[model samples]
Target chain A: MNAPVLAVRNLTKLFADAARPDAMPVGVRGVSLEVARGEVVGLIGESGCGKTTLGRCIARLLDPDSGEVLVRDVPFSALKGHSLRNFRKNVQVVFQKPETCLNPRMTVAVFVREALRNFGIVANNAEARKRLVELASLVGLREAALEQYPHQLSGGERQRVAIMRALACEPELIVLDEPTSALDVSVQAQVLRTLKDLQTVVGTSFLFISHDVAVIRYMCARVLVMYLGVVVEEGPVEAVFGRPAHPYTRALLAAAPRIKPRAVDPIALRGELMLGDVRLDECPVRVRCPLAHARCVEAPPEFDLGDGHRSACWLSADTASRSVSPTAMKAAS
Target chain B: MSADAPLFQIDGLTIDSIRADRRRRIVQDVSLCVAPGQIYGLVGESGSGKSVSMMASVGLATTGLAVQAGTVRFGGVVQQAVDQRGLKQNLSHGISLLFQNAKGALSPFLATGAQVGRVLDRQAIPRADREARISELFRVVGLNHADLGGKYPHQISGGQAQRVAMACALATDPKLLIADEPTTALDVTTEREMLRFLKRLCEDRGLAIILVAHNLSLVSEYCSGLSILHAGQVVEDGDLGAIFDEPLHPYTQGLIAAVPDVDEPHELIPIAGSVWGGSADIDRCRFSHRCPFAMPRCDAGIPTGIRTRGRNVHCVLYDEAAS
Candidate 1:
């Protein structure tokens, strides 16, 4: 296919633990992924699972300690000054909390207009006003909303402004970090529909980061399941969700609350995510994985499970041979 | 309709507020009856007044709001009024509350153990037995007393802190627990664990719980009965199985259709029009403006509750069924 819109290779970030200076906390450890043009790729993980950090790294909001972020065959990590500013205009980010992200003093109109001005998209005042109105209409916001301040607008309205601002410069790739988690379900639906419509109209790829599995299933065609800063599974949404190869992926799918109860009770994942220390050699989810073995101490390689499905687990390595019985799997959890 | 009286019951609960010199009904004619050992759900979106109604029932409604009409009865004892101080004094014996943010509800200065111990102290438990009782409560909520007891509120994780809060709530051995979005702030796994613990608690202790949450799926799984609120009015309330499987009210249908189901993915159609929270005519149907099947008669008068199958739905569409 044509060059992917966004490609990240071995991105790693380390933060020092205040109490234990010797232990280095890996925010995004050696994460490599790609998002094709117009594709809505989902990144799912619990809080502090490095999904947000990875998104920020891709958007260049946070400088990665090491590795490369390429935007359409261009090495984004190497760009500096004017070129970097230009690169930033192509990639925009919408955070989880809209109230904090939006300026309290700025009106909805000025927010979108300011973004257009930063990108140098509008020629004059007339052009900026027209563009701002168009962006507002695109996100299903009324013209009256443009006159209101951030505090005056409702949660759903403020989020619309945030989305409009992200779309102000016509960014090719938008990173949405838990955009709907804050809004009520009814309001979330409206915002999600707007996002889907805009993506189709603009052909902008989305790196959607959310802990809500249901939202991810609805919006994303492909998904990456992260555990402790490492992606344990990556594949087509249907393939991965239908037959999850990794233990972590299984736990997540099982944990998600469904409208209708499942035929069999879902396996409840016991224990919390173990953070701190550098167990670089071993699998990140090994501590919580039910099928963890002695071989897990040494990092498990990403095993191909056919049809572009891959999982980082020792049990999945020999799944092609069907050596591990179903009973063995049930006994472990 | 159980042989015995409900553990907690509220009827014709109407709360009004004066904003901008205009009287508005914030919670209008909302009612619920929770039987012992039954986990009843009060499901609604923000500004729906689900939280307000619960707060009013417990005499916790903030100032400026008055209960014009409503009777709260707990264990055959009728409360004087919605905001009567005696309601708390009488109900405090068997009613406890759990909020969304356990960390915020907990005192920053006190140790986790001391917090739970404080509740036991009010019950007049001997000082010598308080320590052992606190540890038992901790163990019941799946927490380790020895390790987490001494730590301050900031020291524990969100899930662990929530469990500690649960322990504190259970200290009074309450017969009825009013949990408002207890798992909303927690992770999916943690939420499930907490809900399961709650379900078990209901079965083992025969405790009745009023779970107020926005997530329909979470409420459906644990709660046997539910009430769906919209703009301060309970549009639908009854058996969870009936309301969820075949929602009658357009608002209830819209709310369910809006949530994306992971197990059964489908196109989510959001309800049109924002919830009208302003002072609408009390005689008219509140959701009539947003209802897709709105008729001229809907604006004529308020629609009373009509029984269909096994639930009560307040909608003009069900007028024929009521007749």
Candidate 2:
């Protein structure tokens, strides 16, 4: 098999709260994942769940406290100076807010050309202009928009420019952090379609990070459901969203509003999410889980559910041992 | 007022923005009716005039904007919408507003309890009963009064702060509440909880709510009736179920198709162009420029509302005389 484009193992990044020393730090915790070449992997969670932190760590924008990030089997930490600069070309990031990331003074063409020149993707000005036009069309940007500044562009156009800049490097992997959340529904659809088409045409792996469940389901072949800095569930999109094993995942799916009214009542959780309320030794979601049990006091290990599906919950063990369905278990609880 | 009469109604509401001595109609011929205990949704994108129309209906249209025409009826009392003084009086008559950003709307210097108390004070509840009413309002909104009352806005979570805003809105025992994108700042779970709570409030108190939002799915889940606004004009209005089942307007169809569904994945077909805010005096369909089926006559005049499929749709395609 060909090597995966990006591989992360036991990645941990914690931010210390100096004002509240006793409070648990907020950031990504011991995350492990693999993004095969041309694969779209989704990371979904509510605010402060560390999905963004994980994306930043994978993109090397922020250094993780421990663990390894590998690009095509090459350790990200081992690269230095010129080698690191060359290696960085393999991964790119598109932030949530394009306005802040884009330079206000540069036209769309100049902004994209900067990436090309920095990576030496184009040798001459003529080639750079040609590449800029190609990248713009690839991302569904009008050739005319390349001449306008970021401030002159619409929200959707600005985001497309950001994506174009990232694609300029011809990176093997791109980390998109809530790329379409700020866009209108119509504009968001256009951008998401463009991204999907670009992925197919360019064959670039995408680490799609978003809080919108439906978007993640639409864009990703596989998904990781995170909660309080831990991945509670991971599997094929169908296996995870269709037959979610973790209670948190079930609650999240239930909570998301659907265009078609849901047939059943949403599973109401116990309370609002309170960060730093649980110790690392305990399950991060037990405080809010309606079906939490005594076994949930301790952190559960990820149980393999076949088809590459895995869930970190003690109830999955019961489902495996007693052949009890998760729904039946919930009723019993 | 009769029990069956709409709690709040706005007819032929028109608004114009005066910028550098030039007049441009921002909202024109907008109309909406909300019956008691109904959750009516006003869905549109930003700058589409959902907020502007609602604000003007309540006489809170921002400076530099003029209310040109229309009539507002509250509790069977009719008054011209252009009468800002008369419309401002509606605020005291069982009408409350909840904005998008709860934290920013809240008074930073005051405790949550004091904020709620201030509303009661304005309503002239005797000083003796103000504290009890504040606590009751907190409980009604599902907040622990003893815990959150004394805390400042910054001390509470987004959901809690919004509930605090809800408590303030409810302090007057309002018959009609205008909540403009109330849950846009909240997480999905919290957003659902808030909407569910609002539904319960309507059921328990016979309260009518005007839920203004840019999200179609969110409104579809909670609102019974809705009006789709485009470039300040309501292009579609009526039964939510009917609109969802068979949307008639081109703009409505495009908006629904653009939304991504969690339960069912389908190809998204975005509208071709952004909304074009034309001159108020032009008297044409605001959505014609973006409409796929735009015709030469669509440029002639505004498409009047046509009744079909248990709803009202404004489009040339629906005009019996045109086609």
Candidate 3:
């Protein structure tokens, strides 16, 4: 819609261990997605599913081996010098651990002030100080918290400072990698609210990466489910969560313990967890898919479920026609 | 109070940390009880003393921290401290602890099987049967003995390592297990699997477990009862479903509301005000500074827990209702 704030097409990144260079573990393979302006898009997957790699690639923190990244129609992957600096200013990243993301020696003010200075936005210390206070207030941090070091601050406060640093340059898109996963429920709530409030105010598009399905459902408008570097499913958050088409997505939803148990029988995924990529022709989840068949071993089809909901699975056509539940499919398989 | 006494009970447990010759009460009159085959959750934000109180219960409290006041009653016996050398054998026979980072807790030098054998060694189990017992424990925890038992802590995945740790913890056949964020390091899928296994362990073996976590939903789903800690004090503690249905404490209400519900997505209402350690120095309500419904009386003294409808809440609102 109106040229997405950020766009990725056929992104691929391979990470090979130095000792074992011949067998490269899969890291974000042929992933294509987009984040509309002011929209919160969720990237959900289990650990080592390449969600973080995808976030880092989009933030330009890591260079992808292939594919293209377009920031508001401007090519991001090929930019250099001044264009690269401008693109960096247009996007920012906040990591899971605020302690590591921030310097222990630096005060909260300096941590955020440095971001502004690096962006060349503030001219002098006075201007920087003013902006720092403003940023702190924007994230619900008190004025005095700016004087304390990261260690002196609470986990939630440190996370707020991290968010403020991301917002310091006023980027058009912010990539949040498990920002609230580290904090407690109450503190996580505060951080989540602060983020939602800030997004509303700044209208910044966010690529939220988290393994927490509930947090993703609450904070993101659109959801993308990844498995072994592949975007197995993508759809509106409610649609995907309410009626997940992909077997992996459905399994994830069922696995996550909810406040209230669902009426459907829990789909117990069979087979051991397969790490990295060994073969690319068939579906990545074929080994673990409870409903796997010969077709799954041959080809992975991306089926359109309408309303921007799509999934890669061999049972998509049959499931679509029958609208069979995950438990039913599991029982049949 | 001895009628079917809890498997493990801690009452009025106060912990103080002394630094630079100044004593600060970190945990104020904390207490909890766990019965056989029950999952008791202790939920709180970081620095809320949930971990500290737990560590104190097991006698693993860090240096400079002391249990100033409290009684730990385990298996119908009142003990001064859990880590007392005189009670080492009894403690080993009765209690087990699981940490957030199982790899760090495990000895890197020893193979996974050897570590479990060591725990068995503590129980004076004959060396001949230790191997068989280790495999049995691994099987109980859903681990392949040959594949996982031979690997070092570094070799196994985080989830597998955690299961290895669980196998070691269960080596003594302990009656109660203190699991402090035991599943925190694993992915959501792994976490669910681990938790389900733990639940089955409790039900099948009659092992009482204290599940400490910050995720309200996880605690709610798995635990039957829980204690909500705020700034080292138990703001509320009772039936998990009861608290979820009608949380009496403002802190508990805020914490519950803050959790992102997958089924019913709504705007999160984050509790205002950061919890500062220095605030604990005051004798008043620990959460008053951040409490939305705080009144002038809340700053007077620590509110005592008031029981209502099978749950206990230490807040002025409940205090008023009690009066």
The TM-score each candidate achieves on chain A is: 0.93, 0.94, 0.92
**In lDDT terms, how accurate is model 1?**
0.85
Which portions of model 1 show Cα errors greater than 4 Å? A22-26, A276-280, A320-333, B1-4, B19-22, B277-279
Tens digits of per-residue lDDT, candidate 2, A1-333, equal: 788999998788888778788777888777889999999999999998999999998888888888789999999856778988988989999999999899999999888888999989999999999888888889999899999999888899999999999999999999999999998898898999999999999999999999999999889999999998888899999999999999889989998988787989647677688765676677888889988989887778787788888888888885543321221111000
lDDT of 1 by residue, B1-323 (tens): 53266989998999998767878888899888999999999998888888888888888778778888888999888875565576767788889999999999999999999999988988899889889999999999999999899999987889988999999999999999999999999988788888999999999999999999988888978999999998888899899999988999999999888999887789889987677743377877888877889888887876768888789999878888677
DockQ, 0 to 1 scale, candidate 3: 0.65
Cα shift from native, residue B197, model 1 (Å): 0.5
Model 1 residue B298 CA deviation in Å = 1.8
> How many angstroms is residue B181 displaced in model 3 relative to the true structure, after the best TM-score fit?
0.7
Model 3, range B195-238, lDDT digits (tens) per residue?
98999999899999999987777887789988988888888988
Model 2 error, position A9 (Å): 1.0
lDDT per residue as tens, model 3, A1-333: 498999998788877667556543657887788899899999999888889999998988899988899999988988988879877989999999999989999988888888899889999999999888888889989899899999988888888888999999989899999998877777788888888888888899999999989999988899999888878888999889998888788889887867666667457666346554345566678878888888875546567777788777767775553321221111000
Model 2, B1-323: lDDT tens per residue? 22257889899999999989798888989998999999999999888899999988988888899999999999889989898877897656689999989999999999999999988888789888888898899999999899889999988899999999999999888999999999999999899999999999999999999999999999988999999999888899999999999998999999989988787878888887676533345488888878889888888887667878878898878898444
**What overall lDDT, based on C-alpha atoms, would model 3 receive against the true structure?**
0.83
- Residue A176: error of model 3 in Å? 1.0
Docking class of 3: medium
Winner on DockQ between 1 and 3 is 1
The pairs that clash in candidate 1 are none
